[model samples]
Target: MPPGTPFTVVYELDDECALELANKTVHGVCHLGWVPAADGDYELRMAVLVKPNGFLGRLYMAGIKPFRYGLVYPAMTRQWESRWRNRNRSGGARPR
Candidate 1:
């Protein structure tokens, strides 16, 4: 996505809610480790929980090659790192 592009989604805080993220562009589900930062924020459903080296990462590498040719692993790493830094700065909490 382009810079400053806003993403909108509905976050459900129910305990039954799966610890997973479904990327519409990649068309795959990623098993996100149980991180309950937000009780009800749509961005939770879109966070990059699984790295590109993981199972879904390989699939995205193979499938996304045809469209603009981009990989998810690098993106996932960048995303996770940035989020981690932000979280640390906000409240100085370590990743679990």
Candidate 2:
């Protein structure tokens, strides 16, 4: 997970199958969460609190939003899906 910069694991609960990461960057702090979906799949959600230093920070966030969602996240999901399918086929062993 390209979890932005300066992130730490804020909370995790394997029993609940949930995890959260808080990222503090120059522009703002973003809290990202991972939770199991109804069908046993996982999903990622994010909440952003922007305290932009100036106009630049706001602009930066706006500029990156499309790139992150349109490109980065889709690619990451594909890779993750591939790995997951491969791992399952291999009986939980990671392929080298």
> Top model by lDDT, which number?
2
lDDT per residue, candidate 1, 1-96, as tens digits? 225523322332322122333453333333323344565422322333333556766776667665422555456545744664465577764434
Query: Over all chains combined, what TM-score does candidate 2 have?
Result: 0.42
Q: Candidate 1 — which residues are off by over 4 angstroms? A: 1-27, 32-70
Per-prediction TM-score: 0.33, 0.42
**Per-residue alpha-carbon lDDT of candidate 2 for residues 1-96, written as tens digits (9 for 90 to 100):** 334634444553322112233334343444444457788766555555555456676677678889877886577556644544455576663322
For model 1, the local distance difference test gives 0.42
Which candidate gets the maximum TM-score versus the true structure?
A: 2
Residues forming the 10-long window of minimal summed lDDT in candidate 2: 14-23
lDDT scores of the candidates, listed in order = 0.42, 0.51
